[model samples]
Target chain A: MLADQQFLRIPGPSPIPPSVQLAMGKPMIGHRDQQAKSLIKQLSPKLKPIFGTEEDVIILTASGTAALEMAVVNTVAPGDEVLVLVTGAFGDRFVKICQAYGIKVHRLDTPWGEAINPQLVEAYIKQNPSLKGVFATYCETSTGVLNPVKELAAVVQQFSNALFIVDGVSCIGAVPVKMDAWGIDILVTGSQKAFMLPAGLAFVAASKRAWNRMESNSTPRFYLDLLRYRNSMQNDTTPFTPALSLLFGLEQVLRLFETEGMENVFTRHKLMMQMIREAFKAHHIELLTPEDAASPTVTAVKPTDFQVEALRQTLKKEFQLTIAGGQQQLKNQIFRIGHMGYCSPADVLQTISVIEVALVRIGKQLELGKGVEAAQRIYLS
Target chain B: MLADQQFLRIPGPSPIPPSVQLAMGKPMIGHRDQQAKSLIKQLSPKLKPIFGTEEDVIILTASGTAALEMAVVNTVAPGDEVLVLVTGAFGDRFVKICQAYGIKVHRLDTPWGEAINPQLVEAYIKQNPSLKGVFATYCETSTGVLNPVKELAAVVQQFSNALFIVDGVSCIGAVPVKMDAWGIDILVTGSQKAFMLPAGLAFVAASKRAWNRMESNSTPRFYLDLLRYRNSMQNDTTPFTPALSLLFGLEQVLRLFETEGMENVFTRHKLMMQMIREAFKAHHIELLTPEDAASPTVTAVKPTDFQVEALRQTLKKEFQLTIAGGQQQLKNQIFRIGHMGYCSPADVLQTISVIEVALVRIGKQLELGKGVEAAQRIYLS
Candidate 1:
């Protein structure tokens, strides 16, 4: 039987705070009511600092992926040439969404665990002068690798006509993404990941540059039509019905983050990432991505001569742990632990302790106490 | 000033039942965890009955409109000819989403308060043999008109190749939609409506016939990709991160409906619609739509020569009542009272009383005692 209760492990939709959950429990409001308008109005401005841009941040009643779709559909018209940086699943998704809309996508494919090379991207942009847009992920959730968005944005700025769309789903609220200063025209994020809420709504911030392109774009869009939202945003309302309960939950969490300060949030994420990385190393488990490029949200580790699948099952069955297996071809080859929103240092330490116990139970040759001791060192440090 | 603490008195995000609210408050679980998968698996079955289809239902983390877009993009490709029956705002949206994808849409425009004529739809299909699909709404939430889906489905069935897609967003669970029996290829609904949960997730059920078209159709879709969800649904999960809390809330609501039985649920909605209609007549307010075609979920009324907006505002301020305003050009000309999902005769009576009070407050010269009397007669009847 699967572990039936208390799923505190595993990243995202990661433990929603009690207060946020309480907010969701509030009575549902009419999506078109003036109250709903005020809520959306307040939320839009509140999210500006989160994106590090004064540009409009519209909340779509969809997932992070939908925000990415909104960015793709709104930016590129039919037959528009685009450059996509592919490192993991989400980047590949961006490529696919672009292709789906009949947009020509040129992918700068990188190794699964590696980050996109800024120089390579610049060269590609230079070569493909007709490229209408560039899509990249700030943090590749699939491999826990962070692309150098600042450098990539600089290259994109050189192509004044091309829109730079960044899927900051896993990166926003965890890392600093300066949409305005970085010249990122479209930056998208989801509430579930870094916002520390349940997945439902996606946050998108668009510069006027992107809006200019949208004015002339001929692609058919209704629900995620940024223009309708743009018009509605002028009056502090949305075109279609919004997710009010989720908006309330988002407000509570964003306020909590504001009180905590974004810099402190980023620093805390870094500390958590370091704690997990150091623990894996001491336990002789290899980190998949290089240290410099590792995502602060999740850490993927390769086991030392053990059946990762069996170990994962044993961890779930015995210790009630719920870590993630590698996606697609990497399945059973790597296990990932997410130390994202609402996860504290004690969470990191305890999760490591459970992994060490599971490892020893699975007869993983040596290093019985190594992982916990390593994690304890990070906790104290 | 925006009305603060005003309850959303509209049909949905329908009051977020305390049970569903408490369910939504449950801590967020890992998207990949067995706990989440269990929730999804449980939800997948529950959604089928609601969709009136035995076919697989793909759950997207999006609003009702987002699901509508998913259905359009998945079923119809660019340049595909589609017949859209526009009776209300939602039908117009269907046309817009279709046109966005470069699908040529022929609108069978009906008056806003009127339902689409089934015969007209059939004639349009016959005239345009090249038309690949017919898009219509089961319940036009805007005008409170329920279109002739069964009749339209009967007509569309004559053209085996033309897919019949129904936006069941506001009608599902409140009314009967027999997808298989009615030949509806694609039917979409949202959690916010009859499901009595927050607005975030939209559930779509695709017939095998729709799947055949989706298999060959090449309109760009990555986020709302039905195929990805179709393939993933085999494993009882979604391809992207879902709104897990909403899923929990949906599970609780579905269970409630099951315990109550579908027939009883439909009966409740019918009774509520009756109660409201009687009240409107007693108030001497003309209904915008015909009683025969009125939605069981909502009632649209042409308020007596009075400031309809002011009355709605007063209702919110005084009675803590919330109702929907007319959309598009109809705004301020008509007001809609929703009586769907978790609303009973008492809720209908309370809404009627508030409307009467607000009418008097705004000096709408009408007999004050008649409205509640009519509602009482209907409730007793």
Candidate 2:
């Protein structure tokens, strides 16, 4: 059902801007060349404001999971006790990665579709005084819950021994994350999410404390080694041959962000999320996350009278709007609409209109244009 | 100096063809869609003949070094004895990766710019009867030496317990490597080299014996896990979200190879290597690799009268030809000419002409048109 004019409404790998694509299509350059070094120099400073950090950001040629793995390997060694605050699938994956490295994980489990409580995390930290680090997710893409990362970081800071690592893979750009202001130790993101690029490059920013931990950590790592990255970054390049095309795309993406102004970018995503949420409410649909915990990047809605899979297929086949379904345990119960990168007000209206028509065709007994009108109200306001 | 019209002649990231670039610029698709599955299906079979293997080839969204790491993590656990045949920098990297994973490595050290002796590897295998795996490189990109993979595979097969892993990152497509016929257990390659695509995707093919060893190995690995790939491959997709744009580029690259005919592709590379070598000889330049062990993909020539770095700079600044300098210990000692992937007879001629002009400009005593005439002779013959 994919075509030239199709709307990609997935949680990650949002629609790439034309400029980004054009930049990626440019001629290839050797990674160690002066041109590549200039690219690294151009992109490194530009990424700091987006991550809200003054520390050095490392660019890795890998997916988001790889960045998370790098964070784990670099900060904590084997037999180190870490706290994994699990809100959704991504947080569970963080637990899995730590467990794979022989790190003892104390899992703080919250139910699916809910955000982790900062008070509970604080209580756990107070009880477990020897915790080496704590892993949390800024936005749980699987359930569309954006956790209270600022409050959590504050709680972790109250106890200075435990480093705070945030998996900001899905919300770093679209949502406002002040990594330094919130005392986040290590924040990780990927190119596919809000970066408007293909899925290859991963960005990780570490504070002075995280770097100190990495200096003495005895984890056996080679390819995902952060110390090597720190060394190569001094020369304005990566330790390995970088994914050059993606880096090219990233330069244009960062330029686009700067031109648009980061504040406006975040505001636009918040407006899109508002429009989608209002449209869902107008149709009498139930959202998976509470209104306070909903992510600004994606919205998950539970299908009441219609099968989620059938509705998803109808939207894709009929309207050419490709959205995401629920993951893991949430599958078949909910469908998600993504309005992250490269999304505009017009895209939101069109997406809502298509969904309304699809729901009507599937005998959901919803009046046509109700969703669109609700979304247009947000746009007008 | 990396302008739009400049020629990129790096050893790994060889020039990308226009068709591949055009394919990469197509509208993005979700990695979990049917289109992505079809892409996997299309590319999997096409890659087999190129790798000269009939086994299951796993596509990973990482650098070639990650694929080498995957081979190590999947087959050998901690305390497992492995033999690494070091011919150049890439072979030394293999040894480092194994050591990082806590594998006991018995290194067979060969001098730089030289090929590993199969007899020495055979002797090491005979002495280390309990070796779990043996790692080697097909073409050492660092030294431009093409090891005798077929003969080495034969030697490794004689010791049936050890899995033979080949780093074919820079040589698989340009040279003739029959993975099955040569009894190679694991062959790894990257997308940037002879695939005529950007650097991101890596392909690793494993024979049944290697798979058997991987099933019982206890090394802790998550992201580079091969079993996850094997499971997802049943549905013709990757376990993780793949680098979609690179895969799009790969489809076109595979078609280009098919259109050119695989044998003709190999012959074309052989002809380019011959042209460059003959040109080097006519200019009285000294080559780093012995004539018999030279790679058909790259030529590493030691500077005689001219400094290697100075010559490389002249070629870049004056001729817009981006060649490679030596890596690691060979730095500033040798310059390499890459003729892999989209390189053609005309490209070879242009490169040779430019090198001849640069050598003359650098105060080296070389007759005008001599190198081009030697290359033309090889091209016409």
Candidate 3:
């Protein structure tokens, strides 16, 4: 039998809603035309509430990594010192990008499945008073660790010169992020994550403080230049011919989020996280991230007494549900289940039940339907 | 009545085929899954014939300009001498990208509506023997001027150390490009043009010589790094989460091209160019580029009597057919009609007929059906 009914429960390029997919299939329009202008004008303001920022949110026609690069290149100049708080793979990426641009990086390293301590960041800033910025990942998808971004932001604000930059790729839309209220100088996200769209568009919101640093920073940049995006936003357009199909999908997705209310959207994701965690706990599985620091969008579980790859294959071959393997150091030791974007309680229920069977098939000897029952109880409650 | 039956006759984000559209709407798959690997492996080799290269073709999830930046950043280092042959806006962009990287640029300036003379390029290289690279645009979309890339490549090959890099964004698929045979060291193109897909993917093909140069060039790069892409492609994957929907659409598009044959695809585009030029001549309209140097993909027409913007607006309002207006200096002086990718003889005929009506409606007296008659004659012959 053909495995045609595929379910993508990975960290990103998440399951696109049918309406968004239909919207993407709509015919292309001129990127510089009035129709495109009107669509952009309508879409930009709607994105602000999702970002929880009243500042400028620039849309770039690149991946999430490019947005992260923009956040670094536009804010810090060469010879400038910056602090990179590493909890997982993405935080290391920020350090690499900053180092590539000749910035002096002071890394605050944390274990893969743990959150960064905001107190440690404050202590580092106190000693390294010359630092220009501090980079943090709100959700480290690799280990499913949700960092304490609000606390981190508050700590960064204590240093007058250091700008707080958050890589919110896998968390922004699913979790609550108050960019303005939390005083995040720069916040970045991608469309493929919780935006319920395909991979192509990346967004970055910047406060005035970030813009001020950008004006003084002299990094050689072209494609990821935020100033160009800001200038084009005034005319309700982009600096490049945007991925119009994805933008159309984004418009539909934003409308769906608005209809459901942002608070309810966050609550739904939180519930999915809770249900998945409860289901795994009932199966006697241990999560990689500590319970208090686990991401609302993705859950990483340790593969105890069973081959994670074998279970993943069984799930793919028998159930047509695809999840993610661990990255870097944790490879083959853990597996990740993503419940972001258009994932529903039903999706969580199906995923849990299938994992239960796959675990037993892979010689884990887990009780059948026990995990499903746990998830059902959470859904019911 | 609704303007539901719309046609995009613009330069890019061209009319996506129904099959491609349907393929794009297929359910999402894991970026690192076996299914995705198989799809990517199946798709990459098919792209080689269109690119006319037997070398590495790296795919990036960004705009065409990003691919151009990659071409520059990989092949040459800062303080290296490079010749930027300017045909129009995109050529100027190449110059800016090079200059942004601190490359010493020797600009061979051509006017907005003219092609770069290969003899002039040869003379420049003869004078400047220390040039590390020569940047040229295969097709300038802004002015519809197709550069003499073959002859220019021949001239650049005479130098032992210099690399011939061509920005083939607008002409790679629509026009015949023999990258290996033409001695092109690096070639770049975007998906939105003749690939018959949405805007999200960019492609770059590199030769062995370019790879050698990249190893020694020390430019700070991460996301657009060719070496990273090469490393991942060995495993039939990308270094990042690709725009999977566009790849699915590309698979169908490549299949369609294979069904039609690559030579026949090029021939069809050439025929469309001929018919469009003949129709414009029948309307007593002058083309922006001289007959010998015009691009087969897009036709730029100078509006002698009618307002170009008014004619464009009328076409959109009355027939829902969107074409392109002039960019920068050519604004209001010219209009562009793109016949690349999925455009047929009938599309050309209809576009000409509508242009005739639009011109007449905007107070420029033109013979009805005159342009269409010219195109139809070419089609019938």
Q: Report the error of model 3 at residue A63, Å.
A: 0.2
Mind giving the per-residue lDDT tens digits that candidate 3 earns over B1-381? 111246689988788876788899888999999999999887778888888888878889999999999999998889999999998889999999999999999999999889888888888899998999999999999998889899999999985369999999888888888999989999999999888889899999998899888888899899989999998999999999999999999888888887777787788788788889988898788888888988989989996877888989987875667999998888888998888887765456557655665677678866554565566456545
Interface RMSD of each: 24.3, 23.9, 23.5
Q: How many clashes in each structure?
A: 5, 0, 0
- Tell me which of candidates 1 and 3 scores higher on TM-score: 3
**Highest-scoring model, lDDT:** 2
Judged by DockQ cut-offs, the docking class of candidate 1 is: incorrect
Work out candidate 1's RMSD over C-alphas. Answer: 26.6
For candidate 1, the per-residue lDDT at A9 reads 55
lDDT of 1 by residue, A1-381 (tens): 111123345657676876787788788988878888888888888889888899888888898888888998888888999999999888999988888899988988999998899998888888889888999999888889999998999988985468999999887988888889989999999988878889999988899899999998889998989989879999888888788899999888877787678887888788779988987888677889999999999888877689888888876765456888898767888988888887655456556655665676677765543554455456445
Residues B1-381, model 1: lDDT tens digits = 111123456857676665677777788889989888888887777778777788987888999989999989988888888888899889999998988888998889999999888888777788889888889999999999999899999999895468999999997988988899889999999888887878898889988999998899888889998999988877877899888888888888887788678887888788778878887786678999988899999998987588779988887765567888899979998988877787655455546655665676777775543565565556445
Candidate 3: RMSD to truth: 25.6
Model 1 residue A307 distance off true place after TM-score fit, in angstroms = 1.6
lDDT of 3 by residue, A68-169 (tens): 999999998899999999998999999999988889999999999999987788888999999889999999999999999999998889764799999999
Give the lowest summed-lDDT range of ten residues in model 2 chain A. A1-10
Q: DockQ scores for all the models shown?
A: 0.01, 0.01, 0.01
Q: Can you tell me which runs of candidate 1 are displaced by over 4 Å?
A: A1-4, B1-381
